[model samples]
Target: MLQIDCPWCGPRDETEFSYGGEAHIVRPSDPDATSDEAWADYLFMRTNPRGRHAEQWCHAHGCRRWFNVVRDTVSYRIEAVYRIGGQGPGGSHDPA
Candidate 1:
């Protein structure tokens, strides 16, 4: 199993956490003005990149807190872990 390093709880088994899909997905500023297609895209569209991808994870079985992780999609290797709203290796935190 993959080993995840939780920002608050430290290193733990992957089973102790829950994959929260891609991170930094900004919500539509005005849902009423957003078209149906745009709304659907906002709700479902994700960049399933092959290389290093930033994602969200929750330590469900531990602290139950959510955080961001920059991981390699091809190898499942975690590159970095940072708390939500905290700067990552990219030097900025785009809240999801």
Candidate 2:
């Protein structure tokens, strides 16, 4: 099983958390002005990056707070954890 390090609750089972998809994903404000393709792209598209990746996760069974995590997709190893309002060792936010 994969072990995820929670910033607030320490390392725990992967089942204790829920993946929140790619981090730094900002929803468009002007949905009416955006095309259908744009909306579909935003809703369905995601980058499944290898190596170290910054992602958003919710501590479902722990503190129940949403935070960011840097993990290796290939090895399922976590490098660091950080709160939403703080900076992680891999830097603050993911690419926009």
Candidate 3:
């Protein structure tokens, strides 16, 4: 089983958490002015990279808090974990 590190509760089994899809997705600034296609894209579009990818996860069975994770898609290796609104690995800030 994959092991995920919860920023608050320390390392745990992947079963303890829930995947929250791709992270750092920016919502439309003005829904009223957003085109239908743009809105749909915002709602549905996501990056499916082959290597390292940033994702969101929630420690549902533990703290139930959300955080971001940098993981490798092909190898299922976790590169980094950071709290929401905090800096990720290499000092990269969460823009969401």
Error of 1 at 34 (Å): 1.2
Stretches > 4 Å off in candidate 1: none
Where's the lowest-lDDT run of ten residues in candidate 2? 87-96
Ranking by TM-score: 3, 1, 2
Best by lDDT: 3
lDDT of 2 at 64: 94
Residues 16-59 of candidate 2: C-alpha lDDT, one tens digit per residue? 99999777676878999989999998999888887877789999
Winner by TM-score between candidate 2 and candidate 1: 1
- Candidate 1, lDDT over the whole model: 0.92
43: Cα error in model 2, Å? 0.7
Per-residue error (Å), model 3, residue 90: 4.5
Q: Give the CA lDDT, 0 to 100, for residue 68 in model 1.
A: 93
How many clashes show up in model 2?
0
Return whichever of 2 and 3 wins on TM-score.
3
Q: In candidate 2, which residue ranges exceed 4 Å CA deviation?
A: 89-96
Best candidate (score: TM-score): 3
* Model 1's TM-score against the true structure: 0.91
lDDT of 3 by residue, 10-84 (tens): 999999999999988888899999999999999999999999999999999999999999999999999999999
